[model samples]
Target: MTIPHFISIGHITHDLVGNGITPGGPALYSTCAARNLGISVGMITSFSRPLLQPGLLQGIDIRCQESQKTTTFANLYNEHGERRQIIESVADRITSTLIPPEWRAVSIVNICPVANEYLPEIVRLFDKALIGICPQGWMRRWDSKGQVFRKKWENFKEVLPYADIVFFSEEDVSDPKKAVETYLPYTKMVIVTQGKLGASIYSHNGVHRSPAFPTIEVDPTGAGDVFATAFLIRYFETHDVPESARFANCVASFVVEKEGIYGIPGLDDVKRRLNVAR
Candidate 1:
């Protein structure tokens, strides 16, 4: 079997959108973006069987652990563009054992945990891969009523050290600067997505800002995940932070123009947008 060039580990979620439940999650979004960018993708996730049907992922390889219920989230967006979330249910956690031995050496690995379903120990399993982390789920804690709130990652020291890059939003924590500072010492790069304001990249040199391409955002649900996916892929190829950020911002611009995964662009689409932006 050909090894996937990109692998994402997390829970494929059932997002309550309007009157329907849409299949979503960071792992799903990232893998879709990776596939759209012409990379072979793989996902190790836990979800109920019917939640994900045939052909949903198309060419990507998927390894699923059966769960009683797919993790579920109800997202409520306020007038200020802030998202208030309630986790209705959680699926089974993803363990390192679920990852095939051959896949452990894939070129790129993203540890994308939503609802804290990934164990910190899983980060060590990707010894030969460039490990990127989307830490939103680790920074969240929900109330008794299931209302999700921000909380410091209790195991940042253990996980951050193993992560080559870490991605999160300015809204992921109350203090984005502090979060960047905390992760910078451990990881090679830290990126904070500031929604329409664009994103900031923090590395050894200093902080650099990248502007978001102006677009009418139909829904901002998976834009950040798309951005992270684009950045990691570009960085893997070019190894240039500023160039990667510009490319990622352009890729993510398309994600907001439509709903769900429909907006994730292929390379030709991204090139056209880049040329237009230029």
Candidate 2:
């Protein structure tokens, strides 16, 4: 079997809003984004049997550890773009032992935890790959009622050093600026994504800005995952942080124009936007 070039480890979520339910999580978005970029993608995830749709992840290789319940989240959004999330149910935690030994050696690995499903020790497994992190999950804490709130990532030092790049949205932390500063010493690159205002990239050369591509707003559910996936794919190819961020911004622009997974852009769609931007 051909090993995948890109792998995303997290939970495949069941997102509930009102009467509607859709599959979500960083694993779904990032894997789809990577596959659309012509990268061979795989996912290591957990979900209940009832929530598992056989062909939902058609193109990507998936290894699922069965769980009693799929991670379920209900997101309540206000007119001002503020969101309140409630965790209805959570899936099983994923650890290094669950990963296939052969698949551990890959070109890129995205550690995307949606509900703290992924263990920090898993980061030490990929010594040769360019490991990227979408740490929104780690920065969150839930009450006994499952209402979600932002929390400082206490284990940042342990996991950040193993990552080549780390991605997070402005709202993921209490202070985005300080979060970036805290993680910079451990990781090679830090990306703080601000919805319409664009993103900021911090590296050894200091901070640089990447402008967002213009588009009509729809759903912003998976935009950050899309951006992070596209950024890692482009960064692996070009090794230019600014260029990668710009390319990622272009790809993510299309995601916000539609709802759910329908917004993920294909290579042709990304190129078309890039051409127009140029």
Candidate 3:
């Protein structure tokens, strides 16, 4: 079978996590996950080579928007593995031209965000490709008194239509009474991840639920992003929504079993656990 090329959108950051500081930026993890799953992956993200290794550093092709410095953040975590705070990051936004002209050959586009990089307009460019989105990075975030507080934007309502697949957590599913109706029109499928509770998929066709694979979770930082990335690349092999959710749940479980993004499971690990789960 021929490998299909994929372009992951966003930024690679020099993450400064404490007791937790591990390198993670969805652009980095998602692309790594896709490549590990045997998919051809390219990256469309701004990186300061001084701070970020070349995309090839991890099997991803580079179309890096050469900025002076890559975004860097210090994620502080208590013993519980919940991330809080943004010690620092360079402010940079991605425009359409950031995508390399040759990258049009790609079949999948994962719009993983960092800071404010994956804006709606940039997402629209992938209208023809399968787009897997992790909107947490896009959520309205501000550093207040040295800590990060995240919330939905009043105007965030408008960016919904551009994504083919949307990933969010239970906290993001806020006010389900209103969210279900408000978010439905713009999305083809919406995944509400509930940490250990598992994940729920909502679409025009209705809903599907998948329970989480049991694991002694070590880190929660990039679990959702890893879940979305694995689900998109592997599940697309079947396009079965429930299977996709289940595959993602497995990836999430494996993600939490270790510390940081480096914990993202390999294909064999994912396949082994998936088999054991079955």
Candidate 4:
């Protein structure tokens, strides 16, 4: 089999909100976003067999490690759009061994953990690829009661050096300024996404700001994952950080206009938005 161009490694989650249940996690959102960009994508994820809908991953090359229960989360939103997350259950961690031998050399590798299920050592497996990390899961810790809280990523120094770029949201860090200062030296690029304000890219060249495109916001569920995947794809193609951020912002603008994965924009959709922005 031909190797996929993009690979997303993480947990496939069951996200509960009010009366609705949806398939989530960065693995789902990132892979779908890559596919929307016309890239051949693959996934290395752990989930409960019965809980997953194969149709949701139809065209991708999937290596699913079955766990007794899928990692699950319940999100409660406040009037101001702040979120409180509760972990219902968790799946198995993804080790380097679970990664297909062929996929190790993919053009792009996205380490997108949702429950701290991905090991930091997995970064060494893809030495030749542009490794992009979305480390929200690693920065999180949950109590026995399953209330999730922000925690310092103990392995940041060990893993960030190997990553080409790191993506995280403002809400993911307790001290945004400190987090940026800590990780900026380890990676070539660091992006802190700020919802409607867009994203800021930190590099040796200084911070480059990308403004978010205006749209009717419906759901912000997977916008960060969408932005990260889109940014990496554009960065790989152009090697222009500012341009990539702008393109990614345009792509993610569509994702928030609808709920679930329904708003993941295709290449044409992004192109239309890009054209309008120009």
Residue 229 CA error for candidate 4 (Å)? 0.2
**Please, what is the TM-score per model?**
0.97, 0.97, 0.87, 0.97
Q: Candidate 2 — what's its lDDT?
A: 0.89
Worst 10 residues of 1 by lDDT: 47-56
lDDT of 1 by residue, 1-278 (tens): 78999988888998887787778899999999999999999999999853555667998899988899889999888888788899988999887778899998799998889989977989998888888999888989998899999999889889988889999999898899988887899988899999999999999989899999999988798899989989999999999988999999999999889866667889999999899888
Please give, for residues 24-60, the per-residue lDDT of candidate 3 as tens digits: 6877778777777777878777776534334434666
lDDT per residue as tens, model 4, 1-278: 78999999999888896798888888899999999889999999989953445566767898888789999999888877788999999998787777778888899999989999977889889999999999998989999999999998889988988999999999998788788899999999889999999999998789999999999888898999999999999899999998999999998999889877778988998998789778
Clashing pairs in 4: none
lDDT per residue (tens digit) for residues 146-260 in model 2: 9999998988899988889999999898788898888999989999999998899999889999999999988888999999999999999999888999999999999989867
Model 4's lDDT to the true fold?
A: 0.89
Q: Assess each prediction's global lDDT (C-alpha) against the native.
A: 0.89, 0.89, 0.72, 0.89
> Which parts of model 4 are misplaced by more than 4 Å?
50-54
Write down the TM-score for model 4: 0.97
